[model samples]
Target: MTGEPILEVRGLCVDYGLGEQAVRAVTDATLTLHRGEVLGLAGESGSGKSTLAYALTRLLRAPGVITGGEVRFHGRDGSLDLLDADAAALRRVRWSRISVVFQSAMHALNPVARIDAQLTDALRAHRPELSAAQRTERAAELLRMVGISADRLRSHPHELSGGMRQRVMIAMALALDPEIVIMDEPTTALDVVTQREILTELMRLKDELGFAVVFITHDLSLLVELADTIAIMYAGRLVERGPARALFERPLHPYTAGLLDSFPPLHGARVRMEGIPGSPPALTALPPGCAFHPRCPSARERCRVDQPPTAAPAPAPAAATAAPAAADGERTAACWLIDADRETPARPARTPGSTP
Candidate 1:
């Protein structure tokens, strides 16, 4: 509401079926992306993080439908309502205003085409006024932006290493000067060294381009280091969303605490990670009230009967809550243990927005 938000999502719901048996893949989700901010969407598999990403671009297909929501993309000339846009309108906006760098770069790039050709296609599609020479010049610059040599543009997808191919994917996404980039597990296929290198390069690129990023990954630790804000999802609903620092310091949600507990701290040696107990409930028959209630260690009778209202999870009392938050302020969380009416003692202090 303050700065010029580049993207706004409101009451977004994506359902997979019709009538009483309909399953909600994403439920009443809402968020905003400000210019140049990197917002991490973190959760375990089946939490609907990817669904939300695809929905933002109106990319959901078949039985998977955008049952309700408004995705408003703020553009230079005026605000564009993505949910209301026709096929042609959506096509024009897809790569030009918003782009995607998915998990598998090899599949994203055409194995038969040289990298230069793909990059050129993106340029010509978005900037038709540019001549072939001009587009080639721009393509070379993009390759350089992602730390690849311009000469690699002549190479085909099969000829490049996984990291190089991923970099090419990044370069392609950047070619159109999109206002936002959605990366779904961008570093998943590479080795540790390559992952770090790519992430470092991505951070640098983000700094240089000043484009908002929606980075989706289950790796919470990486997100903690790179994201400006974090949103934790559970069973297709955003259980918590707040400033990264605030969320990490005084995480208000039980689900978030479980995620934090599962990751080893950067300074510490590798410790045994205790994953959240039980798998996510089936979407077709999601639990009554809060979907997380079935697996939540802190779940109460009320939690089973009524969904917890989203609220700030305050630090425990000065003496009882262990050490006070390293930082001030709590964050928004969705858990019944934080309910003001609940009798459970104050939970331990954990960063609200800390990542995987």
Candidate 2:
């Protein structure tokens, strides 16, 4: 079901450097994050996924700036433009309304402090009503919520395993009961079993808490399983966005198709992963037109010269607009293939088990 958006990003552009030398780190990223939904941000390392996430959370550093566009956070009171908010306003917004779980949970944690104190610090800052004892109790409760024993609260950050620390990070992020959780590779350092456990716990928490999630990761297979909607980025622009099922079933953008082809299917016979031929282009010196065109197998002449406007989802034979509508969602993409008319010949499809 399509619900009212809790976070809306409009024409958001993040830039680095000055004058003519400026690099567009994130270009015209526009999308909506609905309450209680998880939107996966998937792409190569330099595709601007993390940059876009930082911009929305108003966490960009000086060299990295939001050059244009708006980050709107919808609250019961109304909408807040996070881009324009001051430090004081942002302090109140962070952890209270929106919290972030950075990629490296270990680094995010303080080596000097124990888990109990760390959790209490967040609780005391946001929930000032809680006394020291209450905060400790709450911290223990939070640890329990994340499947970690409260007894471990006395242990230092280094004492806990990577997965446990990540759970603690998640607990801290959820401490103030934020409306949105911006997680950047929450399961990156964990092993497969730990990752699955954490993901399962996260899904359970999402179902229980009903907070929206902006999940950033490069793992397309995990994303397909965990995310409700998937947003694929290439270079600095989004290449595809749609319901995970719809996107995996019939990806419109060539880049999107390539990413899917790269992931080996869990249930099927193992196949060699066909990586995109080239690495992501430099943000400072991106190619003209579609940034993904360089690695895109289906690139046409138009793809190299002109950026394509996001097209509607590909129309199913039953409906004239299914494909176009799939391409066109609150989560929009920027890829030429998605906009190409039916008369244009599609590139050869590569099945998962077939040789590319």
Candidate 3:
């Protein structure tokens, strides 16, 4: 369903400050987003989900720096290294090629400005060829595309409902018809029903527009339904990446299993759930080996002393069938437990209720 690679991130590292005092917020984070696919980035609060998003987009503010990484954005024209792209190149690509719908629409939108003016701002900047009347017409069309009345385009952000404002933000992001849209918790502030509406609208729009999405959220359950691919991050590092259904029904990493357990199933019998035991490690004072060792239920001595490299996990046994296992080379996990299990074929990988 997904097309060719559109955005590729490799060995991306982000720091919060200068050397000696710096906190590594994201370390060696890597993922590829294919055209027209929805890649969900999920983790608990302060897990670097947003940091990775901003860093890759070159939107990280002062005091936060991209210490290391390569962000290659492949457009229809050609490929460009986003991490090294100059201001002019970035401007040419931002709205017209890659757009961002930030976390909260209420805060992202200008409270004083009318929706039409705000929507047309990007068109004015990136699309100067359009006349004043043309830009206004396009703005009105965008509002209607997102299901908001064109008349509401004259309304101010404060005058609109939260859901309406969020829709307007989405409209602005789509105004230029960008190839990629990065949404950071776009529905976090809306009510459950409204959230579903917005998400359904988003998917429908994606189907019609064919733009790739990097959706960042802490809600694993939501991602399960919305994303084609899911990437799980813990302590600033990606712990797992695979097909959404595979990750949801048969999480290969203990951390992933813990996250899935935290959310009760919608159709299954109720069962007591024990979430991950401890807090995430401080970025400035991470443990010696794996940052997750302190909290991983299946952590071993080696896990406390030796960091595990990210690698493709061994294929699931033929008899195992909770969900379809990710094909070879299609799934990867960072966990010493996976390595241990691979070494001993007789030993089964630990699951949610299995003895660790």
Candidate 4:
């Protein structure tokens, strides 16, 4: 079910550096996070996945310039353009309206401070009206909500396990009950079992708290089970996006299919994992046409000559998925193979060695 848009990003673009040497980190990233929905963002390390998230929150530092785009944050009252908001306005909205959970909780958490002091810091800052006792009580309750015993609130970061540290970070992110939460690789260094437990708990908390989440990572397999919608990014642009199950069952783009194959199947006949070949293109010197053509097994002559339009999204085949409505809900891919007419209409390719 496509709910109302809580955050709408349109034609976003980000570049690093000035003039000729500029590297386009994120190009034309457009997506909407539905209210209380989980939108998964997956891509290679250098594919501009994290860059898009950081830029959207205006967390990018120098050399990372937001060349173009619009990031609108919607509330029940009205919408605010985050890109144009002044520092004062942004300070007012950030943490209170939209919070972030970084990749590593250890680094995000204060090493010296007790969990009790750390958790209540946000509440003390924005919510100054509450007394000290009230803030302490609220902090303890938040820890309990995330399945942690309130007694652990007295422990320092070094005393907690990796999983517990992550839970603390989650609790802090929800301190203000934000409408949206951006989690960037929140389970990176944890063990497989720990990762699964954390994701499961996070999903439960999301359902109970009613906050939209932007879960970014390179694990398509994990996302297939946890996410409601999945979007694949390659080289700085979104190549395919749709319902998680539909995209998993029948991917429209070759790159998307390759990512799905990268992970071993949990069931069904056993087969070798044929990971995507070659590395992602360098942003400063990207390929002429589609960025993924070099490693794409199904690439054609046209794929090497022209870039595909971001607007023309081919609907997934109806027979492949049971959720036709979700499949029809904004499924799109930036690949020439998706367009049936465009596939055969291109002129014959010129021979490399033969004279014209």
Q: lDDT tens string, model 1, 298-321?
A: 787877888866667665566643
The most accurate candidate by TM-score is 3
Better of 1 and 3 by TM-score: 3
Q: Model 4, range 1-356, lDDT digits (tens) per residue?
A: 54799999999999999898888899999998999899999998989888999998999988999999999999655799999999988887888889999889979898999999999999998999999999999999989988899999899999999999999999999999898999999998999888888898999999888999999998887788878899999999999988887777667788887877776654446566678889998887899899888998778898899998865454535673345744556788898887543331211222112110
**Superposition TM-score, candidate 2 onto the true structure:** 0.91
Task: Please list the residue runs of candidate 1 whose C-alpha ends up more than 4 Å from where it truly belongs after superposition.
Answer: 1-3, 266-272, 312-330, 339-356
Q: Report the candidate with higher TM-score, 1 versus 4.
A: 4
Candidates in order have lDDT scores of: 0.81, 0.82, 0.86, 0.85
Distance (Å) between predicted and true CA of 335, model 3? 0.2
In the range 91-194, model 3's lDDT, one tens digit per residue, is 89998999999999979999888888999999999989999999999999998898998989788898999999999999999999999999999998799899
Instruction: Supply candidate 4's per-residue lDDT for 321.
Output: 38
RMSD of each: 3.3, 3.4, 3.9, 7.5
Candidate 4 residue runs with Cα over 4 Å from true position: 312-326, 340-356
Provide the lowest-lDDT 10-residue window in model 4: 347-356
Per-prediction TM-score: 0.89, 0.91, 0.94, 0.92
2 or 3, greater by lDDT: 3
Weakest lDDT window of 10 consecutive positions for candidate 3: 347-356
Ranking by TM-score: 3, 4, 2, 1
Candidate 2 local lDDT, 1-356, one digit each (tens): 34679998989999987788788888888888998889999998888999999989888887887899998999755789999999988898888899999989979999999889988887887788888999999899999999999899899999999999999999999998888999999998789899989999999998998899999998887787788889998888887788876676667777777777775555545566676688888877778878777877777799799988875644455354334454444444566555435232232433333321
